[model samples]
Target: MISAGIDIGSITSKVVILDDGRIYGSKIGFTGYNAERAGSSIYNSLIEELGIKHENVNSIVATGYGRNSVQFADKTYTEILCHAAGAFYNNSDIRTIIDIGGQDSKVISLSADGNVKDFCMNDKCAAGTGRFLEVIARALEIDLENFARLSLQSGKPASISTTCTVFAESEVISLIAKGESRENIIAGIHDSVASRLSSMVYRVGLNPPVMMTGGVAKNSGLVKAIENRLGTGVLVPESAQINGALGAALLAAKQNYRQ
Candidate 1:
């Protein structure tokens, strides 16, 4: 059976197609101002690219921040559940998940069977989120792609004491005015994000074999900072950015089978 999953996030939309139990194709695109449009566009793009007609798909599941926006979905699941499923699909050994999205961050504790045991989310604030990093990157006049490389070069990461995104941006600006090294400031930003995320991880209960999902998983500097704070290695799957969509696709296949 062929199944599809769409994850409409604040920053981007992703679509994954599963042929039977294995990945067939995937697509990613900016969500822009309309989640609904983004969802339809990305899904259609993927199906078209794969030369698969929509009618041939057996099931569809939507997830992430704009799950409800996918009017074409056969069903919808919360990102927490989907992320757990995705992590487990990647590695069943993963007992903890840290997903840092554009507008929010969350930590999910998973059972041995890949079920979500408990989860904590930071949605009321942008601190420690992808958007927080974006703001700092803009203030630093540095490309987001270079953040990880430059941060790794820092011998002494500068101090950024605030957890508030606005306050933190101002603090970064102040540091820039003070002629602080870019690498130090960038590393400090990653450290601050790690500090906030580590607290959330601890709150949800830290379990070994942690896996990080979402677009921020690509940030090696942030991952290293989190590892240092947690004192444990973190795993990043190759499909980290599309994990939620992958989970949704897996669930979609299961749903089809149950029918």
Candidate 2:
């Protein structure tokens, strides 16, 4: 069966096509004006790229903060469930999952048999999320894709004490004017972001062999900082951001095939 998943996220939307239980194709795009437009665009991309006729797709499911906005999806699910489901689908041995998205972060604990046992999320703040980094990068007149590259070149990261996003942005600007190197500033941002995220994981107590998901997982510098804080390595998937959509697609396939 050709089942599909569409995840309309706050910052981006993703689509996945699954044939039976295996993913056939997937697409990702930044969210435009509205969630509906984002979902439609991603859906069209997968259909064209995979050369799959629209009606040939058996089922569709949506997930993420904007899941309910996907009018085309047959069902909607929370990003929390979708992330855990996707992680289990990819690697059943996964003990914990860390999903750092544009505006929030979550740490999920799973049983040995691939079920969610516990989870913790930092949703109200931008201090430790991808959106935080993006704002800092914008202030620095640097590209989001280049934040890590510049940060990794620093000799030492400057200290940022505030957890409030507004206060932190002001602190970054003050540091920049105080003869701090661009590299140092960027590194400091990463440290601050990682510090905020580590607090959540510490509070939740995830087991080892943790997998990193969501858009921020693509950031190598943040991943390294998180590892440093936790004293353990994190597994990052190549398709990190799309895992929620993949899970939604998998669930859709199961439902459709069973029916």
Candidate 3:
């Protein structure tokens, strides 16, 4: 059966098609202002790119912050469940999932059978999130792509004490005025993010074979910082950005088979 998953995140929308539990194709695009539109656009684009007819898709599941916006989806699932499933599908041994998305961060503990045991989320503030990093990157006048790389160059990361994003930005500006190196400031930002997330990780109980998903997983510096704080290695899947979509697609396939 052909199944599709749509993830409408705050910053981006992703669509993945699966054929018999295998990835057929996937696409990603900015979410823009209209989440519903973004979801349809991405899905449409993917099918067109893959030369698949819309009717050929047997089941569809939507996920992410704007998941409910996909009116055409057969059903919607929480990102927590989706991420857990995605991680397990990638590697059954993964017992933990750290998802740092554009606007939120979450740590999920999973059972060996791929069920979600417990999960904690940081959604109240931009701190420890990609948005926080974006603010810091802007203050340092560096592109987001270079933000992580520059942090790795720092001999010593500066200390950012605040968990508030606005306060942290102010602190970053102060550091810049004090002649602090950009690399140090960047590294400090990563450290601050890691520190904030580390608490959540422990709150859910750190489990081995941790998998890091979401947009921030692509940030090597943040991954290293988190690894340092946790004293363990974190795994990043090849399709980390669309892990939720993949999971949703898998769910779609399962639901389709049950019917």
Candidate 4:
């Protein structure tokens, strides 16, 4: 059977195609302005990369923040369920999952048998997320890519007091004016992010091996900062960006079971 998974997140969209029992293709792209454009991009990827006809795809499960807006998805699943399933599929050893996305953050706990036991999500505030860091990066006159790279150079992270993104922008600008090195400011930002993230993990009583998913996981500096705060190395999946899509695809693959 052929199935597809489409995850339309706040920052990006993920598409996954499953043929038989294996992944046929998985693609990632920006969410753009709406889920329709994102879903069409996913479908285009399925056709161009996987050589699957529209009729071949039996089910398409939509997931993530914009799950409700996926017109083409036959069904929709919450990002919480999708993240847990995806993390389990990638590494069953993971007892805890931390996903830091563009606009929100979540920490999920899973049972040994692959069930979501508990989860805490921070969706209301952009304070401790990728968007917050992006704002800080822009204010510091550095691109996000450089922001990620420069953070690792810090011998010790400096302090960034403001928790709110709008205020943090002003703080970053003031730091720059005071002749603080951008690298230190970048390091400070990572430290701040890690502290906010660790707070969530602490709430769940972290269990290892911990897994970090979402676009923010792509930031090596952030990963290092989080690891330092947690006092352990974290596992990051090879296809970290598309875990939601992979989970959706896997869920679709299990549409039926034979007696």
How many clashing residue pairs appear in each of the predictions shown?
A: 0, 0, 0, 0
**Estimated TM-score for each candidate:** 0.98, 0.95, 0.98, 0.95
The lDDT of model 2 is 0.85
TM-score of 3: 0.98
RMSD of 3: 1.2
lDDT of 3 by residue, 44-160 (tens): 989999998888889999999999989999999999998988889999999999999989999999998999999999968999988888888888889989977899999999999
Error of 2 at 90 (Å): 2.4
Q: Sort by lDDT, best first.
A: 1, 3, 2, 4
Tens digit of per-residue lDDT, candidate 2, span 1-259 = 9888898877988999999788899999988679888898889877988998878888999998888888878888788888888999888888889898877889888888877888898967787877888888878899877877787888998898888888888898999889899889888888888887777887778588889998888878788878888788999987798999988898788777323
lDDT of 4 by residue, 1-259 (tens): 8888888888888898888757788888888888778878766876777677776677878898888887877788888888888899999899999988878899999999989999998757898788898888778878888877898887767799988889988988988898888889999988888898899999988889899998888889889889999998999998788888888888877873211
Cα RMSD (Å) between model 2 and the true structure?
1.5
The list of candidate 1 runs beyond 4 A from truth reads 257-259
TM-score of 2: 0.95
| Candidate number with the higher TM-score (1 or 2) | 1
* Model 2 CA lDDT for position 101: 85
Per-residue lDDT for 130-215 in model 1, tens only? 99999999999998899999999999999999989999999999999999999999999999999999999999999999999999
- lDDT (Cα atoms) of all candidates against the true structure: 0.94, 0.85, 0.92, 0.84
For candidate 3, the lDDT comes to 0.92
Which sections of candidate 2 miss by over 4 Å?
A: 257-259
Clashing pairs in 1: none
